[model samples]
Target chain A: MGRLKSRQAGKKFLAVTGLFAMGVMLLLPIFVALPALAGGAPAAGGPPPDVVAAQEAEGVEGEEVKVEIGRDVYYKTEGPAVGAPAPKTADTEEFYPRYNFESRVLLWVANQQHLYYGSFVLAVPIFCMCIEFAGLVSKDKAMAKKYDQLAYDFVKISLTAYSLTAILGGILIFTFLTLYPAFFGYLSSIFRPVMHIYALMFVAESGTLYIYYYGWDKMKDGLLKWLHCSMSVVLNVIGTVLMFLANSWIGFMMSPAGVDEQGRYLGNIWHVIHTALWNPLNVHRILGNMAFGGGVVAAYAAYRFLSAKNDEERAHFDWMGYIAMSLGVAFLIPLPFAGYWLMREVYAYRQQMGITLMGGLLAWLFIIQATMIGILFLTTNYYLWQALGRMTGGERFQRYIKYFVFILVVGLLVFITPHTIVMTPAELKAMGGQQHPVLGNYGVMSAKNGGINAIIMTTIASFIWYQRGNRVPAVKWAKFGNIFLITFFVVAHLNNIWVACYGYFIPANVRIGLSVPQVAGTLSCLFFGSALNLAMLSKSRELGPIRWGQIAPRSQYALIMLATAFTWMMGLMGYIRSSVRLFWHVNEIMRDNSPWAYTHTIGFGANVISFNVLFFWITILFVFWLGALGAKKAPVPATQPVPGAAPQPATGH
Target chain B: MQTALYLIISIVISVAYFQFIDWALMDMQGLDYFYILR
Candidate 1:
């Protein structure tokens, strides 16, 4: 045990725990900060003349500490001796205890609403696509009708969830008004038209979701299906717009513009809308939310599937799980890039803030972020493996599992390692600087090579020959394709190794910048290979029929796990991004000081993240269950007695 | 011609925006000496 504690295992455990602690610490700060920053500041009833004069009198006549810059006194200059009290100007102490209570509630509501909307927008639509595709390709009419009914049922579930989303949004607005009335008033003044636009969009989205859901039965015919699906497209557009409109408020708060230094209102609202990091965040949030939503819905499907009565039910759920996992991972693939873009914007807006997020004092939060991401990838890979058994030719490919596991573990360890350590002076000396030279390289490109290489492999594995589920490749070019793939992976691995090793020697800014092309290269390999494989398999033969309805209950849980991981990771990363500014309320406008400034441990952060995720899923599940309970069960799909008679696996059902 | 025109426009706009931001930040930092970065 002692030896284990002293070895690499101990190091990894410590690193992982450190990652979680960082999340708690970083997230706690915002809960403490918003109230402090936005609260107080210019209370009613102007200061007594004597109070102002007492501030001016003390000792020196010319030493006026109150330096007014336009309408707002940005700061109070240093005055008198150390023992002398701070020269409290008009609303110097900025104390509004009454407002703070409500503001706190408002902030929590906003955060929750953000999460809810994030999950709702993504989960519902993806479920529709999944069940729709499922129904569309079913072999027998009864089976096809069942799929259609299930797809219809899925949209019905989303319709109810959408209502919940609206209710939550309403609560958020009410909380905002009750808590920070004046601040809300000021923000509202700036966002009057934007809010109107958002309201209109909400109406549009609600109409679209309602019409689409209610019209499902009426629109079951051929051309009607296309029209019905288009409503989904419309709903997504409106949802995206709603997110963007809401972002204007946060973007303005963080990167406030449209006003001069004095807080005077500027006429142009667009200046207020596109606050520095706003657009990137909009993109990031939309994608992240969808991925998160996908996770919740997937988890719901998993939970439901696990409790199914018969083999047919299990089979149906197994497919649902696979569909959910695919949708979640698809969105997830672009998340890191979106995050990178957001970080770049953060740096562009304020370099110090970016450093604080990635490499400075608040860097621990990002360590937590790395850990979450690692878990997300790990869960996704696990789900894929579990899903393999559900596919036809799945058994034969089991031998490749060990290789996938190896690459994944190596990648995760590398991804989560700290760039530099806060060690004792003695420890630092032994390691040569604050970073471990040898161990550090593992954290660099070699590890990324392991990670991305593993992911690419998994993506390749995901493209299982649906035709025979267990059928081996038989095309004449199959050998050549395999050779080409091996060569591609080898070159990709070496390319990462070359870059990562070379990165350490470069300047810090440039070194970090190199991640761009490195990521690009990995993605190129991933997408190109997947596309090529699909093309190759297009004309391939199938030896057996797919056994869709005969899946393991535990396999369904894998999809749920995969999706939940994405949601949790999104929230963790979002928190990290927001916290990078540290004590700054709005770049330079307000400073923050609260007890929640310290980083909480990884265990604590993960628990809370899990709590939020569980809360979302459980509520969503209840909604799904309730909807299913009230609605008439669609007709059961009747297929031929011999399942997998002819492989019908084409696209996701 | 269109590409050249767009390029010219973009370059001019970028340069102007960059300079404006630099000037604003410099002015704010120099005058009050608030630790905006921190």
Candidate 2:
């Protein structure tokens, strides 16, 4: 034991030393530039030291030297405008290559494909990090081994997808340069420093990921395992910073900053990167990527489960699917809030852009988005219900599922209803207005907000039931706890609807504030309801062990549906965001005179998104096949079913 | 009697929680939550 303690101390020292080395590597470029920046200027608002020295050496007077200074657009500081204005490109072969196909379409397909693979690769590492950590912390020996294997499986799949991501990224950059050289040149020039850092960070991420994956077996013991897990943290940090740098370019295009009216870059790189929409976009995209990654992983597990040769394989894949779905749903729950914050920031940046997104030409796409969101939640609930069948005591909660169905349907209908419809003259005259007399009432944000929150609340309740499926509360305050939870959800649902109705009666300004309380009500149920349920179940008795592989085949289909829908939604939303810039290449900064500047019809956009989703699934299925092929030689996991002693996977919280 | 008491207490607590959240969030945005009552 003393030897073990001393060895542990030695590992701690090594770990600290390793961490210090990584920190220096991460900040090395910045540190290298510090001396140069310090030696640049001799005094405030004076000529640079190099310029003064050159003048003195040439026998020129100090007063003869005049340095031109420009003010930073966002930071409001004085500095040299080192970058040029955005190029004005004409509709010619020089500016846009005249292929038989549309350049915009080609670029769109490339960008979408790259983004899909990129989000997947980034998201899988995060899952590996979390699951690996869970393994390290778990007290159960067999469960720890299972978790470790699961995390390894996740990384193995990502290793294949990572190469595809890099290939697609290369294709996207080449497409940009070939089709839209002028625009690409300007964007790259303005983000020169940021681009260099992004490239370096990408390289760093690649090195770390390779080491993390390859060193897994050698580092699977003692403090080495802990060090291996920490490496994932470093991997994620580099990945996130890389994503942020990419987001800055798009954010600048949507709402340019740190540049003058003529599009001259200001000296402060931070001002350029930290545009108005940067923070919200970063938050939304991260959550979105995580949820998307979860869906893809779940679908992979489902595919494996459906084709398993034995009960052992089936049980292993079932548990894996559940864990992936839980991680995905965990991110999905807060995704809408992040999206809301993004939309709010868009409105804050430019109200016209927000109007374009929610109320104008792009409004139909939002309806599609709403439908997708509703489908995601519904599928999640359905999977949970099917999952409950594996538990002996789950039947007690089965009766409540139909009521949940009714509530969900009602919420979905209200959420998807359009405020206004495009109608011909005669049709409009027949209806007396653009909105329907009865259904139109449900179209407004107030009602839609209530509808979504209701759906979310029902999902939360479904999750709670799934958690308590095989357990009977044994706490002294079980009855009171049950009563409180029921009362809270009831009131919360009613309050959400009441707030929605109240909005119609009040002034518009005050009505807008109603959404805050409505969202709060849903979140309250999530936190308080779950807390109360867990407390009641703290000393619960299990009715029977969870039969992991006993779920219906239809549940796997639900997982596939969730993943496909997530992919389609990501594609549609990306198109909507890019289209909101309209004819401009960079909002008010740069204009695009391309032939395909106009927005495509909703049908066309939908078709393109569907194609992208289909293509992604086909390729990903191939990747999954490759993973399965390797599984023959892979070490067997400790997840084999042991009669009535199967381990319980963590619930989606 | 015990069930009734529990019901009453639950209603009071839930209502208070929602009301506080509403008022505080609204005030944070510089909006008056009690505009209707006023």
Candidate 3:
């Protein structure tokens, strides 16, 4: 025993020392680069005589003009304005070479892959923080330990993917430099300072993440655990900042600001970073990353559950899947609202761009997106309902499933209905127009909005049912609370449909405002109904200890399907957003004069998205295998109780 | 007044749809029977 104790002590000592060494090594690069970064600035040069002469001639007598002109010369900004004369071919040629092959497709794959890994690494740490906090607060030692173990497992999966993210990022840069050197150079010149900060933050995130993972065992007790969890916060902050910096680059491309009509950086890097679309894009991507991460993690849990040999292993993985799915669905519910805000911002930035996306060329893609979203919600509800099988009292809610299913199906049918159909001239004539007379009305935003809100509310209702699946509410007012909850949902649904219907009669300007109250109605049901359910269940009686490992195998497949759908949807949406710039490398500022400037057919786009999804799944499965091998070598601590044993609720309330 | 009537009627129909489901399938009065505390 003493020998084992000494050996363990030696291992812990080495682990701590190794972490310290890694931290120092990581900081060494930052320290060396700091001095260089501090001294690095564009070479001092006066504004060109012609620019100064022109400014004076035009009587542009302000500090802003002089400053802008000076910065323009330094940054080599030379793009045409929105309505200005088209830039000469020679000017555009200097930045982008005439590539023989399709460079855009190559860049697309690289970017999407990087984003997937980047989002996974960024989001898993957040899950880690939440789970670790849950562990810290729980009075039940066994349950707390289980939470910690689950968190540790989550970080482990992301650790391998982090290395892949960096590798993919390097490939992305190399692709840009080789294929689109001119365009990359111009962008780099504009975002020189941001690039430096991004690099430094990357190093910080890497160091913090490594320390957090390696020191997990050592910090499992008391004060060190809190410190360890705090490291996750620092990691996430750096990660978010890194993401924001990258987003600015994309946002600037989509909606160029802080520059002249002739693509010139106007001295204010802050303005360039905070372009009009920046915040909306940031919000959209953050929510997207969280949802995608949840899907991926849930898929990982499902894989483990399917392969487990023992009931204990199965039970653990089953619980993990539930937590991951719940987190993912929670983010999924509000994702459409974020998407709506983004589209609104897009319209605000440029009406033509918005019209092109929604009503013109890219409208078909939105229809495809509707189909994917419908599938996502349907799968989520199905998984939740399937989960009910593990609860003893869940049978009581079984009959209600059919009703929810009816609502979901109808909503999905409405949500996916396309406004126009692609057909031959004769077919179009037969229909009397591009739209089917009967289905045309269901295809517009009014009907779609109603459909989605109803879907969301139904999903929320499923969740409430799932929460109460194993418990019999013990509160004296449980019936009243249930009645109020049901009534609230009914009313909320009515309000949502009313808003949707009212939108049709209102003018377009007023119709857009209707979405606010519609979303509010859904949120009211989500928050208030959930709150009521929880209050009633606080002192509830258990039907039985939840049979965690008893869930049907089909539900595991649903988890995989959710992940696959999320991956494909993200790829498609990224393509749509990027393509909206249409023929322009930087919106109206810099035109893309490549052979592949035209948008590809929807069929081709779908094929490419599927290829990317397949590639990601294949690669991620390998990563999962690597994680599994590591787990086998150093298994999670067996602090959890045996399978089928009920975890005692934390007491002393 | 016409718009108001349309809106109100739409809401009523929507709410009534769910209410019909409950009346047909769920024994609403038996809800408290499932609650152990009550």
Candidate 4:
């Protein structure tokens, strides 16, 4: 009996030891990772033995070294001068070795995928805010309920994508550390404080997002709904700040300011964070993100619409698709102007860089970008046209589509026209010059501007046509209003064309300024013309109720195409922007000595971008599927309006 | 003189486009009215 008891005691002791070992194995990583998360510093104890031995081996002793434990500080130079080459010391010559393939390509894929998810998560909450507010103020109870349900759906879709964004971000950081460790180390050291702020903001954003999403049903009534919407506003603010902080890092890389030629950090952290290109990049990226988010949401709605089992489901998804598309297109309209501003800033910062981007090595990439833009605008117009089939009197406007199509096609042709062709030596000699006799004229910025502006105006006109579908203005000044709109558009077109023509006769310095007035003319038409139309349709007569689920299935495919085009264009532009800083780690400050520092061929770059686009789409589609699975299990609440049962007149006009 | 001519042409085109839209809307409304009356 004593022997049996001893055996049991031994077994018990063994079990306790195993449990202790397992617990330590699991909890050790949390303990190690916690210090890294807290300002990315080392633990309370001194440096690890291996790190100390490596530092000693590298002769990194007694040099006033700032021992950044978790973060790697690649540069050990003491206050390097601006515009001067960094000292080629053992400490500064940090090696970034790629295993098999090019490290930069891997970095590009990770960065683009991370950006795609980040933009999606950042953009959807703003849409949710606007939609929820609309629901709050809407007098139509049924419509309000529908809007609330839609807003809830948007947040639900974004939630899964948000987790994926964090995962992709972690992947991106790992890629940077593994692939371009030296560059990342230097960048992190300079923006350490901002990184801390960014981490804190991320935590706040996570808390707010969770609270806002979970508190939706609980705060569905009167004052609580308002409070819930206010939470979205808070969430978006944190998100926007986070985006700005991230942009500062990229902007500093593009246009390094506040540091001397040696790539030294100037005393002011704010100065380092707020580089010359910071605000412009911020504005451009924000607008682009909004448009991209809208496209993604619209594509999601389209997918749902296609899979909807009943007419009620179809109607709900249809209306949701329209709303998301409108939001997407609205931001898309102003996106080009923001892009123009960004380009102008790039030119102002460095004319040589701008030339390389627009007129030199990257020019062909711009041609491809133009094709993508043309596809985007064309697809948008096509979707709008297909949407008209849902309206009662929409057939009347169908005849006008051919004219719009003609203009859009011509514009696209001109916009994508290349200044030069890839020809054989003999063919080049035969052609006499790089410029095609006829098509070359259209390839210049002068003609391209005219083409794109025309496309924009035509798109605006299409929107107007869609707005007028199924409705007749009952206002007394309707005729006058129509005449005013016609005249305004004509003048806007004249001004745009005149500016384009005028650019050819002037010096480039003056010609660049002319885009300002050209953009202003388009804005006036969009703002004033839209305002006039709204007033005219304030109490419009409906021809018939719109059949929400009547649009063609092909239109949904167009939305997916739009999102894909957007993703591809973003990747291409990012490649161009980054490649412009050729052979330099931080523009002119630090030279890149890596073997793979040179820009890839256009074909290779295109393939990489396409691959990134494909990967992002595949992953995002999975995220959407996961979201749909959760949605499928949840029964539609009684408070939500039944779609298609009460067909309301289109109020978007 | 040339610029004025171009401007006039643009205005005329714009007006014509507007006129087409107005005509189409009227025609549709007329068809709807007849359908209801009949």
Fnat: each model in turn = 0.00, 0.79, 0.02, 0.07
TM-score of candidate 3 on Cα atoms, chains taken together: 0.82
A120-188 per-residue lDDT for model 4 (tens digits): 999999999989998899888888888888899999989999999999899999998887777777777
Q: Candidate 2, clashing residue pairs?
A: none
Q: For residues A1-653, what per-residue lDDT tens digits would candidate 3 score against the true structure?
A: 99999977876676566556646754775887675567675322224469658868767655444232422322345432212222433334454554665778899899889988999998899888888888899887777878898899999999999999999999999989987776777777777778888998899889889989998987776555666776777778788889999999999999887667676665556567888899998988988998899999999999999999988898888888888888888888889999999999999889999988988899999999999999999999999899989989999998889999999999999888887656799998988887777866768887899999999999999988888888889998776566666767878777677667766765666566556667767776777677778789888998887898899999999999999999999999999999999988888877887667899999999998999899999999999999999889967566568434333211110
lDDT of 1 by residue, A135-194 (tens): 665667766665676567567667777777777767777765654444566566657668
Question: How big is the positional error of residue A371 in model 1, measured in Å on the Cα after superposition?
Answer: 1.9
lDDT string, candidate 2, A1-653, tens digits: 99999988987788777767777766886887676568673222223469657868766553554435676555567766556877888998888775798888899999999999999999999999999998899887777878898999999999999999999999999999998999999998888778888888889888999999999997887767877888999899888888999999999999988877778875667678889999999999999999999999999999999999888888888888998998898899988988988998898888999988998889989999999999999999999999999999999988888899999999999999887666799998998887778866768988899999999999989988888889999999888888899999999998888888888877878888888888888988888777778888889999988898889999999999999999999999999999999999999889999999999999988898899999999999999999988988766664543334433333344
Candidate with better DockQ, 1 vs 2: 2
Q: Write the per-residue lDDT of candidate 2 for residues B1-38, one digit (tens) a residue.
A: 99999999999999898989988998988889888888
Indicate the worst ten consecutive residues by lDDT in candidate 4 chain A: A68-77
2 or 3, greater by TM-score? 2
Model 3, first chain, TM-score of 0.86
Which regions in candidate 1 have their CA more than 4 angstroms from the true location?
A1-106, A126-147, A422-468, A590-610, A631-653, B1-38
Q: Give the 10-residue window scoring lowest on summed lDDT in candidate 2 chain A.
A: A642-651
**Which runs of model 3 end up more than 4 angstroms from their true locations?**
A1-100, A421-439, A636-639, A642-653, B1-38
